[model samples]
Target: MNTFKYRQKYKSNYFEGWYIRLIGKKNIAVIFGITTNKDNPHAFIQYTDSRISKYYSFSLNEVETTNNSVEIGENKLTKNILILNVLDIKLNIKFLNVKALKKNFINNSIMSFLYYLPLECYQEVIYLDGEYTHESDKGRIYIEKTYGKKFPKEWIWIQSNSLPLTLASAKMPLLFNKFGFYCLFEYEKKQYIFASYKLGKIKIMRSGNTVNINIKQGRYRLELHLKLNNTVRLLGPTNNGLMTITVNESLDSNLSVKFTKKNKLIHQSTHKDIGAEVEMKNHS
Candidate 1:
């Protein structure tokens, strides 16, 4: 028997429970495998506004585990992948050998995947890199939904057909947020989708001089090649899915971004139609 406990919080929804983790250390199976629609021993969830907890929910990939204590091939087994049936949906997952448990369940119990969570399945994730030095400046970014304790780093981004801007530590001047404000630049009416992290990977498809952002979710991985191809499509786990985009760009390289999940076809960079001035103004 194992135990797992944790708390989950959302702006609109509420969830925090001591779930059960089941591992079959009692069995003598050589290799335990599984399939699932959620992550191993855990599930990813999102919340919606103006709704109850059940109404605003979604899930992503899942994991399963076994208790053979040996390295086995990733395949299905003749056992029930899930030990607990508390979550709304049921998915398949496998295990190797039962280890520790979590949430009143097994801790770090290895499992296999039968399916993945019902993500929007964007087929794309773009990674952005930068630092956030100011409070007000950071608040201006609509990413507060994903914000955490720190200054809020590790950006996930998306963009339009226009040119994309890359911000380096050297390119973006250190900013102050409390009292002062500053102007971001736009070199040629381009757009910028970005996030930041200590390190991660990026995959993209480039056509001619311009580059297409297929996935932009985390830092760069030096050991692995970051490119989108038929053989290697899934870019792996990101910090989160929230992404940002700068609708306006020019040579000055200042960042004016509106956090839209989808890229809008028309950009209002003009004084009237574009509302460049009003766009810059963010009120509490």
Candidate 2:
């Protein structure tokens, strides 16, 4: 089985989830997931329309999965298409002109550590960029994919199809020590990775709701700036039960990202309506 596939060997205290984001024209953004949280497993659908947000949850048994597809009741999710039907919303979307992030030795090697670690959570970007069309809703936008073996207790995730960037940084428990700040940034078709196992350097500065990350690898440097806007509370998994975690996410936030190689600028861009999440204890 592929290392990135959903694992079926989880323990009673473990959880696994898939995060699928679909952005459409006419100011529509849908973020939903299928979660198996041992204690309270379920499938959830959330979306925003005209600045109004709504959420729906269904039983875990309502979800089924193949190797690369997921079926939650009447909703289906795959790498190629998404057919969702919940409440008053119905969508039949197809992903076209897909552009996935290339998996190489370096990026693939970064995840090798998980094979030896006894950690409770992990994550990866399954799909980076793709054009999508919603037939029923008459909407069109970009789509992306993210799945994980439970979310980290403290982490910050940011992504933007407009900027064509994906960044995730986290601090979690690893064995007897803390995982420290490990980050992965993909931009301009290149991956700038900084992890504890790789012995790279990462510095973070946070003030109020804004976060700035500076990372240095062998001969590459990445700088990311993110600011939070109004957020909503979403259901997340804990060790014993499901908890309502406040995800400070804004599809309207601003992001500035720059990548340099050998002290020379390689790429830089500023994006709006970026997707961001800051989930830390007592912070969001």
Candidate 3:
């Protein structure tokens, strides 16, 4: 087994990375190892539905110290954390239980994500590079993916975020709310496929750190290369509870979120308002 490493500094060799668990109910667990160009810090999280397969890692930036907000991001799946000292200068991604999950799954991409994420991602969602409150009711968007050592061959990828705005986002994209999540696994004929189902009913309550989510009916297909950018929001509560999203828009053809599992749309979402905005939480 190769020992994972990380560094935090703006030195000749800046560092940043992290591994996350993909199994849990409410709060996901996260254990992490961080090394900057100069310092190394370790951290963990408190998952509501904690899983045993914890795994995580990350390369720290030079902006972290020890005293700062313990959390980052908003909503349930969001990577918000309780920072000890670091402030706006340092962007720390303390996944609730990211530390343990990374140790459990031990995926290799973690290293790539840490160093490349700062550059590839947008800043905090509040600064809102593209946050908009529009009135174009786009329809529901569906997505499908195959999990395993390699991507699933039968499943392709597609989304329906281009139709309109003001329409609630699809559940597929909301998974970004947490550091860890779960995927369905099964085998067909000769190939093995792992499916990641969306939390049809997700609630990002304002009172607590945890949230609620449930499965929705119906299934769609997508390609292996599809990159999903479904909209996600803290939909108000319903009779059952807080409604993540309701597909009532499909009735009028204007109030639905776009999705795909079997087919692709003519055009894709040109904008992503309810997308992940974790990169902006840094202070450094």
Candidate 4:
């Protein structure tokens, strides 16, 4: 799980970003990204809370990375701790009881064998508990990283460490046609994984302000419904630069998830603080 994903040297048409969400009394997300497009190479930090969203950019030379951490200017993010020092905000948070995905040689990560393939984009998710200065501001946290030449044409991410679930799917280009792939991970008593490589049937539907998604793999099934709320525009990475792609994200979205085995229900719950992101060209 401690794979080095950040770029140390400048490269053309490449970008890597990490989405670190601190889900507590005041939900905050600290996003770090670096785009190496010869013409416009730089690093950035995007800070978002319940009320405001801020972005800071710097030169590529200011970026530092290790196998499990990335630091841009005064902001730094790792597997266990995150430090922020931008503007008047100063925070030092530590992640406790961090639960990461098991890694193997053949199927490196949650993406299965595709983690080693030369895809346009790759994503990895991690769940853990976080603590800051106040106890009320210490709770569950969700972290995900993406690195590649570019993101998929369309994609949706739904995650909640409180619910301990994450579902990410995208329409990836293959030659001239496009194929869909997804990974549904839920941890109740144990981790349940339903992914494309596991012969799963995944469907995503958009209706008005809500999106419905269903996944079936073997005898286990997962159903998710998300309603967008407090949606805001955020910067995403492209081959050109970090600000070229627009991402619609809602940190406090309404989400309902149902997981079952065979014909028996395993878990069903509704959550108000779900991290949801939708990046699409148009509504279908």
Candidate 5:
């Protein structure tokens, strides 16, 4: 598949980016984004680790896309390998036991029917669970991509490779007000899902730096509670420009998740380190 299809079409208010997370000795995240806002269309990269974070900008022409790879300047990303050279940091990482989403009606894309329709923002999962190695430091990794005009005003994103779970809820444009969705596997050796179109109900609550989410669909229920820790601000694309710190990602956060079926516990996990980005309607 052409993961970089949006990059070729130079349209106004268009943006595409790949989110790459490398969990090794230190949790690290890299964002490669290209925006075509007419006035200021450029390609940029953002980096964040436990200690420091930085951003780099280049002309749009610096971005190169292929069948399965996207390269910007000296950095390159593919399904199997990732090469990076920014500032003093360097890595030549290789993904192992990579698991891509199945190619089917619902599994092929997370958006389901909404994927065919044009929306402000569309997200795709490239890799569900994978392992990475960079010399002596080795850990888990997750890969995904987003292409559209701009991000949602409010959203919550959380993922854990150890649990092989990913959940997201965003304020989508159009008839839908706010949508909550999740995809998970390897839970008691079974696959369970909760999505907007699946006739699921979700409730979100926020108090200070802690947030809790509950989703119920038929006989399945998933709950996620998190407390922010070691967070760093990251810029996101907007109609005005790519200057808004729309995302504050927590590198190492406390997360506890529960999955149940038929009013019985199926699986549960607690992790001290996880990847998350959350924005609530009312935060006190």
Candidate 6:
């Protein structure tokens, strides 16, 4: 199922969230989501402008979604349209030239492994790239959905349509003192995955506001250099509810990437104004 339809499933410690990002000309951006955590489920909309940043939250009961559409209070999100009406902010946008990532063996294998884990979190990319129009201006947009019992203790997520890449690497809790380190990279239209089920290696280092990642799987290797700035706090999900954890995200960031096959450089590029999240600190 490419779309999320989990309203029927009921659990004490379950959580689900969808992340949507819209970029307009001159890098004007909006990021928002609807989250359902057992503790304090809610829907939120957030945006930052040159003068100030604003966030709005709504009760969980006001949120509803199907395979193709999402309604959060007065906000509506679908494959081709997004309408937001919160406080003094109002937005009506349309998406064009939509391109979605297709399911592949890599993603399927990762899902299979997560399904068997005790602390499971499933992730899927609903849309890879699309043209978003706000009034007379247009920019790019990317969307993703995630669900799980709880988030990993530590993880890093970075995505950029300008770079046309997505990377998620995490360390998840498991049974028998076994921990899972999973990394999935979508670059140059190819999926390079590293998980517990594969013979691969991943190294991550964080220095200040920058993160460097190196991943090797068979003959393929990828190096990602990410820098974060203008970060803001975003509500995150937990077993108890939305207040159990804090997520720090930045829409103004930079990403430099390199890919190699058999020791030969395949592609290299750098992109700016990326969407990134780093949740490594623990909060009780």
Best by lDDT: 5
> Tens digits of per-residue lDDT for model 5 on 1-284?
44434443336767888898877788899987888777777888889995677888888788888778878899988878889888787889999997666665544676677776767777777777799999998988888888777788788888777777777888776746665565555564444557787788888888877888888899988888888787788888777345455578887888898888898998788976688888656542
Candidate 6, superposed: residue stretches over 4 Å from native = 4-9, 26-41, 48-53, 105-116, 175-196, 281-284
lDDT of 1 by residue, 19-42 (tens): 111112110101121112122222
Query: Could you give candidate 4's per-residue lDDT for residues 1-284 as a string of tens digits?
Result: 45435743236778888888887778888888888877777888888885677888899888888877888888888877888888877888887777666554554467777876667787776553333443346677777777777777788888876667777777766524344566545465566677777788887778766888888889988888889888777778766444578777889999888888996998888888888886643344
* Superposed Cα deviation of residue 195, candidate 2 (Å): 3.5
Give candidate 1 misplaced runs (Cα > 4 Å). 1-6, 11-80, 83-91, 97-222, 230-284
Model 2 error, position 264 (Å)? 2.2
State TM-scores per candidate: 0.19, 0.82, 0.21, 0.90, 0.92, 0.84
For model 2, residues 38-153, the per-residue Cα lDDT tens digits are 65666677676436667788887787777777777898777778787887888788877765545555454335456446565565555555677765553334443334455567
What is every candidate's alpha-carbon RMSD to the true fold? Answer: 20.9, 3.5, 19.0, 2.5, 2.2, 3.7
lDDT of each: 0.20, 0.63, 0.21, 0.74, 0.77, 0.68
Clashes of each: 79, 0, 93, 0, 0, 2
Stretches off by above 4 angstroms in model 5 are: 1-10, 240-243
Arrange candidates, best TM-score first. 5, 4, 6, 2, 3, 1
Worst 10 residues of 4 by lDDT: 127-136
Cα lDDT tens digits, model 3, 71-187, are: 222211123332222221122233321111122233322122222333211101110011111133212211111111111111111112232111111222223433222222111
| lDDT score for residue 134 of model 6 | 81
Task: Report the alpha-carbon TM-score of model 5 versus the true structure.
Answer: 0.92
Worst 10 residues of 1 by lDDT: 139-148
Give lDDT for model 3.
Answer: 0.21
